[model samples]
Target: MTHVPSAAPFDPQTATIAIVTFNRSNLLTRLLTSIGEMDPKPGRIVIIDNASTDDTAEVVESFRDAVAPADIVYRRMETNTGGSGGFSEGMRVAYELGSEWIWLMDDDVEVLPDGLAKMGKWAPRFKSIQGRRYDYDGSAFYWQYRVAEPLGIPIPFAPAEFDASGYKAMNSGCFEGMFIHRDIVQQIGLPDPRFFIYWDDQMYGWLASRKTSSVIVDEFVLRRTREIKQWDMGIRHMNASSNAYRYYIMRNRAYIKKYYRELGVYRPVPFALGTTLTFGKELIRLVFVERTVRGTSNLFRGLRDGRKIARDASWQPMPPLEAATTTGR
Candidate 1:
């Protein structure tokens, strides 16, 4: 792990901001422009383009001559590897470039200038605080990291210790706008490429929690732009809700279950029961609720494939998806 320089330095070594972008050229440009305004500027900035066919490359190039303190490196992939692949590539590049800390931001998120500064302030404290554990009380648990209020959402602090019988960690949430120590990645490997999209961040964060505790920094605020659109289902080259998403969620959960089992951190009976219930819900939705023919077919296929992998103890490697050049029209 590289040593990160203090926020205040005489000859400052800057933190690196690594962003993963696809065909969202406009959003990417906005994020980059916002990053350029950060007060204590990052030392380096890296953008991994997931084979975007749009004007993404040109948009990035426009910022090359900007007077920002950070050195910009834009990389283009030959194929689109989805969010998981793009994030992995970007983080690897940032680490190899000797960044002390890596700030992972989604292309569609708009981060304010003070966001990193606030994160840096809270980071050391977050690492030092103890985690909250819970036991199953035979009641449903609604564990959430951020608490919503009439005024706004307040970040929840983890207690030093709590009951630990029949309980598991709640969702670790999304990785976007996350500030990570480089060593955490070194200790735990990169995001699982098997998870092409959904739950990749959750899996990575869960593994990291085993190495060192993580906290949701309340001060660092990021706004995510929600744009409704459909995606190509790979083979057909037709726009639809991605079948690949369903496949990943189903398959990778099994992979995660097995991985934890091997580590002696997971118990099979409860996990199996929980997983079955979860997948069964999806099955019910596919059969009774889902109106789209393609979506229903994909859901059934995902469930069948997922069960097959679990039964045979053999998981196939994911194939890269073709990159779409058009930012949803």
Candidate 2:
């Protein structure tokens, strides 16, 4: 069971915007600008830099000077920690800094000027609230997933389902534009940084959903500035062609398996079959349709290596939040 502050009022001032950024200084600047334009502005902003060689530090310092009144703390990591590590550190810092609510987003996703105010309206209703997102072209970005009828592994949702209203239970989540309360952070701890990249956010979402009420407010919208490179697979949008992304996507099955087992929903044969079917389709597309053998080997290697990663009992979850980090600029 999770702790729910039943009658507590949600204070917008208690919100801290936790942003994880890499090399995209321009995108980060744009996001900070959006924050500057907020009607009810964010009280605090914690940026976790993933060790970018670019002028990420300069951008943060510039924003600190530009966005007066909003206290912005930027921490540049000693190494290039992936999204998982950056988010883990950012969430930890936000909670420790006494933020009742943590508004999480990647560097690429730009929050609408009104997005924070909109989500704040329903902050008192749910333990965890997920905001909606749009692609660059104003098209509906469907990061939400449809859990299998029996509620096991979540699959990509239908495009038509994007317009559905009324808050509903979500099986997964994207940090793309998620609003997380501190209670979930305290109870669930940080996202497993071991995931190192993809699917970690959804795993955290699954963990939070199991413990408390989590919902997506259809009215609140956050637009993603990242370009969509997905290949249309008739039934779903599969990865187009990225050697770098494929490695992490396939390698992180170990974390997903652990995620399911922790939730007591691990159906070995069924899960394996479901995964095989899903990946098999992509494998076929990679070899035949796209005719790209570049990342196919990674897919095979990831599947093979993930089995080992899942079986490692010694591996543990992310450590508890600690002291403040160095101001890296």
Candidate 3:
């Protein structure tokens, strides 16, 4: 059944969604199901598959008729570009398609039926609007909040600060339900695919916010169906147990530092100190808490790599997406 559009202030047809997936066709199917159930469906859907060795293509093919008027653009990458690169290409395609707004999320999340309509109502006022996220257990997935200047850690907003139409000033962004305008993309450029994963969205959102009005609209909700116990203490504690996660969390700081250096939005001294503290805190977690010897070693290796990355004299900002997909890396 085609769900009729509600009396929302903004038109639903102006927004598009970009979902990046890797080896999770089931979850992607679930997300598509959620989109199909929306009362006011999005104008378009863009799926960026990171070369998954599964039935992802078939899963997307099955949705062609279900979304009705909403165009589905599926791109199966030649290689695995990781989440950052995948989203980079995905948003690039969405930009070219000419949607006024772009909603980004991972395969693990499913939108509440009213989520887009709720956000669409508020979209007329803000340039970038992020929606609230709920966990699989239906608890508020509380990671959404502001970032402290220079340091860029996710600090919690006070209980009283949360309101349906109001929003706190944001210094970072989460891709779970991030809604950004096309103009912001034009000014800030697509997210750096080189990030490859962790902190990519945060940096992307920060750049957009720096250029335009960005806020978290409390009315809309995205259900984050995956559960994790690794992150806590406001974004400072990255209790990463996996070597890959630890490496990216540590190595990516170099890119972040370089970004700030180029942007010159925040002071350099505090940014430098804060970035070092990020590695130091991770070292303690790996060494003292988890007591993983190899994890700590990888942290150190990431730190070494990050320093080299920071010192790269020829580094460029927002390199072409094609270069990121192929040899420019």
Model number with the top TM-score: 2
Lowest-sum lDDT 10-residue window in model 1: 128-137
Provide TM-scores for the models.
0.71, 0.87, 0.87
**Which 10 successive residues of model 3 have the least lDDT summed?**
320-329
User: If both were scored by lDDT, which would come out higher, candidate 2 or candidate 3?
Assistant: 3
Clashing pairs in 3: none
Top candidate when judged by lDDT against the true structure: 3
Q: What's the lDDT for all of these models?
A: 0.58, 0.74, 0.77
Stretches of model 3 off by over 4 angstroms after superposition: 1-9, 156-165, 230-241, 266-268, 283-294, 319-329
Candidate 3 lDDT for residue 79: 95
Error of model 1, residue 209, in angstroms: 0.6
Q: What local lDDT score does residue 329 receive in model 1, on the 0 to 100 scale?
A: 10
Question: What is the alpha-carbon lDDT of model 2 when measured against the actual structure?
Answer: 0.74
Q: Cα RMSD for candidate 1?
A: 11.5
lDDT of candidate 3? 0.77
In model 2, residue pairs whose N, Cα or C atoms come closer than 3 Å (at least 3 residues apart or on different chains), thus clashing, are none
Per model, state how many residue pairs clash: 0, 0, 0
